[model samples]
Target: MSKVVLITGASSGIGKSIAHYLIEKGYIVYGTSRNPREKVVNGINFVALDVTKTETIQQAVKEIAEKEGKIDFLINNAGMGITGPIEETPDDEIKRIFDTNYFGVIKVIKAVLPIMRKNNGGFIINITSIAGYMGLPFRGIYSATKGALELTTEAFRMELKDFNIKMTNIAPGDFATNIAAGRYHSPIIKNSPYEKKYKSTLDLMDKHVDKGKDPLIMAEKVYAVMQEKNPTIHYKVGEFIQKFSIALKHILPDKVYEKMLMKHYKL
Candidate 1:
């Protein structure tokens, strides 16, 4: 029997690409979007889901459970981007970022865990970012959200092993996607003293994203994890430089790593 897989934020970008890839691999794929009115993509079922809303999450999981009987994989890919000086970022903006990136992920995982437990075992891939490993100059909150998620995944890995449920944090460096368009920016950034620097940094960030690695490569990584009988606790998808930078951060001295980041981002 084909595995039943559900991926959030599948309307476009990495999630959408993953959904397509999984379908090609013969997994039954269900992709979620906040707008039910969005046109459905061929070969993928789109479910209405707003990760910020608990009711919608429960309903989406229930709807899938009713039809599929069991969920074999859950991809927590629904997230939004926020940018601005951390000092100038509005409280609401910070909350919104965490809501979609951190809390939203927790909600979906909670809703799906019981189903996975009932099925004996299942795999969960949480879509995180390389920024989660360290704080960036202007995107501190976004980093914080992903950092919180990575730590939470670590805890989940230990707690869920007894039930045979596999959880992995899939951190991608940068990918060509529509995330730039949907990214949130604090209004205060316009008036802040650091506006010029913020704008320049934001442009630099976008430049790298524009040249980001292929989403198909990320999909392949996801598929590889799916094929694993026992997957690793973490997997990264991105260009060699980005992957190497992550390793370098771990072993390098704090000042050295900080200088490297500062030089790279021109901060």
Candidate 2:
């Protein structure tokens, strides 16, 4: 029997790409969207699930477990993006992002854990971002959420070790996707303190996404990780510079790395 895999935020973008690739590779794949109008897409079973809603998370997992007997793998790819100067961004918006990106992931994992424990083994892969490794200009909230998730996964892995459940975080750099469209951008206040710099950084961020690598690169990386017996706690998939920036942060002094980022963002 083929393994059963569940992926969140599968309606489009990176989640969609992963669903398609895994299904083609012979895994029984179920992809979730907040509201899926279709029953299936390109062989992926589509289910309705909103990470922000606990009831929906439970129902979706229950339905899958009832049908498949066990969920062999889980890909927590459901997350939203936000960009704005820290002082200018709304508190509600920050909470909203954390609710979806961080809390939502934990909810889904909780719903699936019992099923995985019963079956004696399972794997979980979280779709974090390279931005999480550092505090990027105008994208601080987004970075914090992913960074928190990364640390949580480290602790989660140790807790699940005795249960034979494995967990890992995959941080992708810029990818050509509709994420830019979905992101919440705090309005640029004219003549405000951060107005000029915020506008410039926002434009630069979009350009990077426009020229980003194909989403399939992430999908390929996901598939490769699933094939491992003892996967590492973290994996990064992106261009040389994007991946290297994370390394530079560790190797360079605090001010030096800060200067590099300020230079990159033209702050």
Q: Which RMSD values do the candidates have, in order?
A: 1.4, 0.5
The per-residue C-alpha lDDT of model 1 at residue 158 equals 95
lDDT of 1 by residue, 1-267 (tens): 999999999878999899999999898999999886644577888889999999999999999999999999999999999998887888988998999999999999999999999989999999999889898899899999998999999999999998899999999999999898899976544567987778888898889889887898989989988888888877888888888988998899999999998888777
- The C-alpha stretches of model 1 lying farther than 4 A from their native spots are 38-40, 187-191
TM-score of each: 0.96, 0.99
Q: Tens-digit lDDT track for model 2 on 1-267?
A: 999999999989999999999988999999999888889878999889999999999999999999999999999999999999999899999999999999999999999999999999999999999999999999999999999999999999999999999999999999999999999999999999999999999999999999999999999999999999999998999999999999999999999999999999998
The best candidate by lDDT is: 2
CA error at residue 102 for candidate 1, angstroms: 0.6
Model 1 vs. true fold: TM? 0.96
Worst lDDT window (10 residues) for model 2? Answer: 33-42
- RMSD of candidate 1 to the truth, in angstroms, is 1.4
lDDT of 1 at 183: 94
Count of backbone collisions in candidate 2: 0
What lDDT score belongs to each candidate, Candidate 1 first?
0.90, 0.96
